[model samples]
Target: MKLSFYLHKNGAKYAMLTSIGGCISILGYLIYILNPLQLILDKLLTFQPGSLIFKLWTQPPYEVLAKIYIFNVTNSEQFLAGKEKLNLTQTGPYVYQEIVHNSEAIFNENGTLTYKPIRELKFRPELSVEDPDKARIIGPNIPLLGISSYMKNEYGLFMNLGFSSVVNMVKSPSLTNLSVTEYLFGYEDPLVELASTYVPSWIDFTKFGILDRLMSIDNGNTITMHLSTNTTSKDDILYQYSVDIFNGSPGLKQWGYREDIPEENSPCNTVEGAFESGVFPRHLKENTTVRLYRKAFCRSTSMIYENTDYTSSGMKYYNYRIDQNFLSTSEENPENKCFCKNSKKCLPKGFGSLDPCYYGIPIAMSQPHYLNADPEIRKQVIGMNPDQEKHDTVMKLSPELGIPIYARLRMQINLNVSPDQIVTSSKPFQGMILPLFWVELGIYDMPSYLGILINIAAQIPTIEMVTSYILGMIGALMIATVGVCVIRGFNQNRSDVESENQGLESSPFLSIPVQPIIRSEFKLLR
Candidate 1:
């Protein structure tokens, strides 16, 4: 009885231990399979109110520097006399800190948000090569040139003659020496005042500042973006927080695309699916192409993958550059034909017309020093030295988060001078695309705190993997312990049975005895 009781008690104990081990193993496996780490990460990366990413998007922590380099005309006399090609000398890198803020953000129910961007520029003298107010540049008369170019196309002969008379009365020089500050911010010119007075509809502002007009923010302009938080699908997550609309429209009316036009017909004017320079999508791949939209540019520009690289802190980044065919003529890149504004004649292979967006001013944009421009266009200028290192537009982005680690966005502003026989001052600049200035705007490096956050975000996958492995190991160990318990229980039960049988065989009273006189006893009974 005692032996039987001991065997039952030990068997029950083993069974209880096996149940506990099985439960622990199952718990460990469930933890690993559920992947709670990923859930936490997704929540952190989502762009919503009170989220880290949203805060960063609203106000970036790093500084964006604008370095302006103006091109000074050195041989204006000789060039005007038709004796020399337009000779230019590159001038100072007047630095400014550009502060951006997304104001009055409103979150919508359809997984989108809208906000107005307010940007301010502050001069950083310490970072500049020289004082802009004191630095002088002998450059083309922008007011005279821009007006002459506009009138040549829009005004009749009588209007052109009147404009020519006004120009002669004001004695506007074909080229003028002015402080860099005046050239960039604003300058007092009688021609500009007269134009504003006469044609307020076209030239409302009496002062014309290239950078000032470019950076001016319209209060009514707002940007709507996809939050990318509604779905957990990988593909959907790849395009997180991309632009959805600009100024309440996906395509610009200025670029000949109205609300009625299909997006496929006017792809160049489509602003949707592009990202602002401050933020990009997550999980960027090598083959992925990115488009950046800026109000100043009036269109989105494409950036293609160039190579893979590492930041100074050992974080991985993917390098991208402005598409080489971004400004190419239709002959070179047919897709850019829409930029010609329905005209069969497009600008030369290098220039992009900005007149549609720049108040009828015949301003064109190109890469700094006309890098990769047509040989003919470069031949027209004497001082153009297109160095890839200094002139090319480049952006280094984190592959995982699509964050811009370092970027240099370079662009040169040029005036398209179409000479008018009626306007004699413009005849000197006949058939010329004059480079006025170029700007390099970007951040040099990420702040240390931002780098730390990026590193942590990058390590999330590894952390999740390690955690899963640990949980799996724990589960395996618990399962193995359960197996050991089962084996030991079976062996103990068998040994107990054997010992009980031996006891029965060795017992005095409980044993069975064999009879020797069985045959004789059987016969007597019969």
Candidate 2:
């Protein structure tokens, strides 16, 4: 009705009407058109992340992707198809990176993912969460992907009273190192594949041709940062192969495909007669919510025009009004301003909710034992990648105070620079999460009750087993002594008056001591 009414009333603005109608068509079908029973069942059974479709939203693996690190390999031969043998001089910045971007109102077709040689690219960035003002991410790999680099440092400072680096401490060296099984390759099997008869009419792609239309419309789909590090620079300037984009992968490309179908479990791999086996619980529904996310990530370069990224680009720091917040137990807003680095910028949190603040430590393959690590341990082992100079220097000066997570991460980044970039973060940020006393009542109660029950239960076993068997050994030696004492007493014919029996002190078998009486206030309980 909305569409028809608008068409008739403002048909004069034919272009706007036509364009909005086109969008409505794509979104309407992506949502109301598809059904996947097998996909739903598999997700529920495995409790895979996708089961959280309402929450996790397609399980885009943003955390892992955010942490991907890149390395550059200098080559003289043609590395990518249709490329040339270009030698990099032994000098300054060299390596390059690639970050992929896509936009299509919904999950895009696979053409974009299938190997495309490097095209236009923004500079690969070398960023530091420890120092947001120092974000240096650009096209390929000149030095950084400051976003991940910063979080890595923040994780490190929160972990060790030790050194961190903007460059070397990067725990994982390649993008492949950061992997998530959010999607199956749309495999076909009879269990997950329903009879063509049961399939719903709305989702029959052959008739609707949504996929064909999606690809044809230019939603400005693109893959950002797909270049190698130009490591051969004037040796004096800088020489390292860090590609912020592809995170070390040279020419490898990624692919995406969607099947317009449904089943009991999942629509992918079949198992135990079910359509598919699993989907991660955290991942969102592909059909219902995937299109909604299209806007969040679609990168409306238009929005970029409206707002300047203070922390990302080179901007004067003091110009924008500074704000803070406390996510921990204190008064929950940023309070008290402190002087920061001379350069201007903001932390992701400071930039407000422009984006979700994502942090991670790359899982290193060199030491595969990291598979079962808890979050804290993982942060310790993974560390950041600012460079040796930065990590070691800041670690020498303890950053925690009166400190917050963002501050600790920032001061650590401050270590790797000319005196000019020295800065500190004033915002109240959190570090590795720990239980706050008042907030975690549940954690305390369960253990105390279990201990009480276990204590009472242990008494039965203790008396039944130890009173005899263990007592036999201890009683044997004591019996002999008692007998000798009795004989001695008889020889004496008289005994001295018995000493006073201390209540609990005299009773050995089951004496219960008086426990400390807590004050009335402290004794309060739920």
lDDT of each candidate versus the true structure: 0.80, 0.22
lDDT computed for candidate 1: 0.80
TM-score of each: 0.85, 0.15
Once fitted onto the true fold, the runs of candidate 2 whose alpha carbons sit more than 4 angstroms away are 1-380, 385-526
Tens digit of per-residue lDDT, candidate 1, span 336-441: 8778874334789889888888887788899999998887888878889999999998988887666898889998999988754467777888788889999999
**Best of the candidates, lDDT:** 1
Q: Candidate 2 versus the native: TM-score?
A: 0.15
For candidate 2, the C-alpha RMSD (Å) to the true structure equals 36.8
The list of candidate 1 runs beyond 4 A from truth reads 1-28, 217-220, 229-240, 308-314, 342-344, 478-526
Kindly list the per-residue Cα lDDT of model 2 for residues 55-109, writing each as its tens digit. Answer: 2222211211111121222431242222632122111121122223322212224
